[model samples]
Target: MGIVVIKLGGSLIQGLSNTFFEHINLLQRNGKKVIIVHGGGPLINNLLLKFSIPVEMEDGLRKTSNEVLEVVEYALNGKTNKDLVIMCNQFNLSAIGLSGCDNLLLEASLYDKGKLGWVGEVENVNTSLLELLLTNDYLPVISPIGVDKIGQKYNINADLAAKSIAKALNAEVLCYVTNTNGVLNSEGKSIEKITKDQVQALIESKTITDGMIPKVQSALDALDEVQSVAIVGENFLNEDGSMNGTVFTKGVVFSE
Candidate 1:
């Protein structure tokens, strides 16, 4: 079985329906090994507000300060990760929740201590445990938090973390399950498929902007490492296995 890494954003967690888990089950039933890396933005922000800490975002990524990093960990690891794991168990998926800081699974240094504060760019992914868990048929739900050599923890962008892990595991595809349908064209319609060249063209044309731009660009970068990448809405995957999303490939794009 091949690996499939999913980057599930916190923003979409509340809206995830039973149908979504069914689709995940469908993937597993078809012999696809699934791993999940998730974010907890809304939850983090809420906690930050509850504690009177100002929330900051830079270039679609969170600007995590030491103070905010604590809250981020609480949201991602303590709350969101456990929630997803329980949800998977409820569906008989049998999930194990983990953090990049667990057993040095992911090692990293600060991305830019000055710019993004405690944000991290994954320097290395330790795939041994991951492979072991996958071999045992357990889905790993990962919290995107990395630790440095000196035992300093940094918040990692879930998408980038998922991409690095996917590349390390040689996953068949890395999928971003977001709230939107997919990358849209100028007319606000989901583009069926896209190549790297077309992604650049779309970026230059300003058709992809705001949060969606960063997501597609992240997927574009991940495409170089993974066989294929996709950005789709939570419901984009149908019971029939047809999908509504923009797929990015290295060369010419084609429907499966």
Candidate 2:
């Protein structure tokens, strides 16, 4: 097994069961190198409100000003990363928490200054540090704040960050550990497989609507660099080592 980049959504973190960690351990035991990237959106929002900072979003990206950037870092790095690292450690998994700025893991540029201030687009990912940690049997828990060449750190989106890292590492899968049970069809059941083109068509037909649009779009944007992407809920693993999720693969026939 090779590298598998898993992106844990902030909203779903609290509900993650012990079985999830067991699944991770099973993957590690079977020779799959795991890299975890996590988000803390809800925590960030709470802090923003506490500080009286106005929260805003532009196309699913947070609008980060200088003040808000501090709070973002506090929530993601100081709080979420710390808690996740501890969780992994409690499960006997050797883990270390790091930010995108650490060893220049993620190099980014300002996405849109006018619309989404201080938000970043992942210009590139340097996988050397990640490889080093994985080789040493350490799971790297990453927080998605990126740094620029001029030492400017911008708040980045966790989903895109995981995708970029997957590309750089040539990971087998970019697994989004989301709140939903994959993408749902019109019947409200999880579609086992889909193509990015099909996802776009579903969006056009309104079969995939509202919040699901950005999730699928993010997966689509990453397809050029990644071989496949998966969307799964927290309880994805069964006792039998099987998984339930929707996998998006290019140029492949769709099936259950």
lDDT against the true structure, each candidate: 0.86, 0.84
Q: How would you encode candidate 1's per-residue C-alpha lDDT over 5-62 as one tens digit per residue?
A: 9889789887689987887888898898999999888899899999999988865788
Model 1, residue 46: distance off in Å is 1.5
True-structure RMSD for candidate 2: 2.9
lDDT of 2 by residue, 1-256 (tens): 3887888989877667897788889889989899999998888989999999998875567778899999999999898999999999999989999999998888999876536788887888878788889999999999999998999998888888887888888887678887788988888889888887789888888888644665677777777777668888887765775556888877666599
- Candidate 2 achieves a global lDDT of 0.84
Candidate 1 Cα misplacement greater than 4 A, ranges: 204-206, 239-242, 253-256
Worst 10 residues of 1 by lDDT: 235-244
Tell me the spans in candidate 2 whose CA falls farther than 4 Å from its real position. Answer: 205-211, 238-242, 252-256
The RMSD of every model to the true structure, in order and in angstroms, is 3.0, 2.9
In angstroms, the error of model 1 at 256 is 28
* Error in Å for residue 208 of model 1: 3.0
